[model samples]
Target: MKGILKKVYVIFFISYFVFFTSWFPGLSFFNNSNKVELNDNVKLQAQAPDYWPTTGWRASSPESQGVSPQKLQEMEDYIVSENIGGYIDSLLIVRNGYLVYESYPSHIYDANIRHHIFSCTKVFTSTLIGVALEEGYISGLDDYVLDYFPNRTFDNMDYRKEAITIKDLLTMTSGIAWTDQVDYYQMAFSYNWVQYVLDQPMVHQPGEVWNYNTGGSHLLSAILDRETPNGTLDYAKTRIFDPLNITEYSWNLDRQGIPIGGTLLHLTPRDMAKFGFLYLNNGTWNGTQLIPASWVAEATTSFIDVEFDQSHGSGYGYQWWIYNWLNAYTARGSNQQYIVVIPDLNLVVVSTGNTEYQFIRLLVDFILPSAGFTPLNLVFVISLIVGTISLSILLGFTFFHFKKKRTIKKLRKEFFEETDSNGETFQ
Candidate 1:
């Protein structure tokens, strides 16, 4: 019995260590290797025929060139105060292909930091759909879901399952009942995530009502894997990543060796900015039409009305979020990460923040107001200046406080260790 107990203890320790090690930081299991290499002499450059304006200066200017600086500052402050989630890592605002403003907060600012983009990975997944269709791997958006997955079975094994289409998944109207708030982290760790998602009971008829379902997105990934001769990641590397010049990145794969389409994509801020720029240019990069133009239009169009409270106010498109402001649409993630595109102003604003609701509120209340082209009021300008100064001070103090807390924790640990040694000696 004693020997058996020792064996069990050893097994438990090994399992725990393996699990933790697999999940540790800086040891991502995803593969993001670029499969295709371009000629060394070939140089790709951004081709913007005309440059956007960047004029006007005031202490609290309502607008600068096209977007308001005061409003941008206000949004920044709100994000810091709310303590959103990860970090307000990077922000870049571009107008007519010219960079207007860019910022990287001190806490999460690093050239090589690849932030996890949660469900924002859906946007990339959707883009792959467009690529597959354009490349003739997919017949059309109307192609039935079961056409690819002939062997798979659903809860309602009927013709209704046949009604599920690529478009249905993109629109989030697949009629599949799914809970987004559930602990998906545990589900991701399971050995059969694809089977688990597919086996979910159908709650309604296909395309009856709009429902936000991440599982549907995974189905799309499965479809891509089936249709393409090469693996999904390899296809993305050749078709998307190679063309965009993205070398460093990672994408999570499920137990079935399929990319987890709904979430967990890690990318550097600069590479993320490239994606934003690609969409802003209407699927064109460096004058090359990488994705079909019609697909971009269709993808950004509102397919379902989303309930946006203080946290978020946007309609859902093909894995994209369409905002009511200035006919803007964005690829957004939890905790305020966004790549907002406004076609009218020819502007693209990319902001990564930790604060959830406060960041959205700031964008609506402060950023939008300041984006107007009109002149500013004197009192408003002074207030904006004061607010900027105060917010800077607050950020400084917050960082200092966090540092002090870490110091105290280290000291306490040392003191406790000393006390434990003394107690052992007394015993």
Candidate 2:
């Protein structure tokens, strides 16, 4: 009876240890999970996608691209159940250059539908500036902003306003005393939009302060239009739109026929992913370098401490919102439009929505955590299971052997004591 109890205890202890050690990754020695450190600058080597999404994206199962489908589904469910369904038009996730997950929440929106990306256009504009700089259409960022508008006259002209440079406009440090609250509408209604932006009094010296100025962004488009041989629209079509094969899109122009630099560009969700992918690959597309790689690094790097959305980080780049905290950058627009790039994850996410609600929670809470789960290889899995089982069996046998000897010795002692009480003994 004592031997039976010892065997049961040995089996139970070994079984418990084996069950937990093999099943739970946290407790397992064979866990191969990879934690993504976003700030790591080491880029993944250039591996071509199965096919370029010039025409359309190739869809794949999320799991195939190292993403968890259940978590993605949970993300969708959270959107619907949390009453965030109506606001979002589309959400797209591209990992390892494949469209692993896409969600069009509304019947009106679809894979091919072009949604207005608002201030996401600014990032595009910033990209075009990089291209323009590379092609020599624009000399450099340090060129005086007033040099492009030599023919135009403005109000409150001073040395400070004249001192503004193209870099300042790109960085939103042009010191234009324009406020979105009143001046944005005023500029929209003004007959000469470029003139309206330029006419604003200089409140700070160029590169002196960081201000959220859409007017400064428009001024960039104006400068590009004036500097480019055929105008900014033609330059973009030839250099950017054509290279990426983004055919179905529209760019709203001001009364002067200049493309709205700060807003009003419409694009399909897939095309938006293409742009993010372009940046993710460091401005190279296909085999050709569309925008210089150096410019890509420069454009995304944070230059100023800003007071923008805290969740998105306080750093600001050239028309790009820098989230150094997350080691990601975003082309954020009004109405919650975004093209986010996480280089370390090799992921690009695009979201377009109409309501004022920011859906970054969908990325921060759901999509990001669902990626980079490095499952153990089949060999590793099999070896771990077999090894643990063998170890458990050996440990169980040893435990039972020792337990049996101890039990037998105790039984012999008890027998001797009983015999002595009865004045009898067994050999």
Candidate closest to the true structure, highest lDDT? 2
Please report, in order, the local distance difference test score of every candidate based on alpha carbons: 0.67, 0.82
lDDT of 2 at 243: 90
**Candidate 1 displacement at residue 374 in angstroms:** 8.9
Going through the candidates in the order shown, the clash numbers are: 3, 0
In terms of TM-score, which candidate is strongest?
2
What would you estimate as the lDDT of candidate 2?
Answer: 0.82
Error of 2 at 278 (Å): 0.6
Model 2: runs farther than 4 Å from truth? 1-50, 373-427
Q: Give the TM-score of candidate 2.
A: 0.77
Residue-by-residue lDDT tens digits, candidate 2, 1-427: 4565566556556555655654554455543343233233533323446667777788889999889888898898898888877888888999989999888786669988899998999998998899899988899999998888877789999999989998999999998887787888898899988989988899998998998898989989998898898988888888889999999899999999999899999999899999999888887787888988888888888899875664446688899988765557899888789999877677899999888656777777688778853222343455556656666666677787888889999998998898899998676
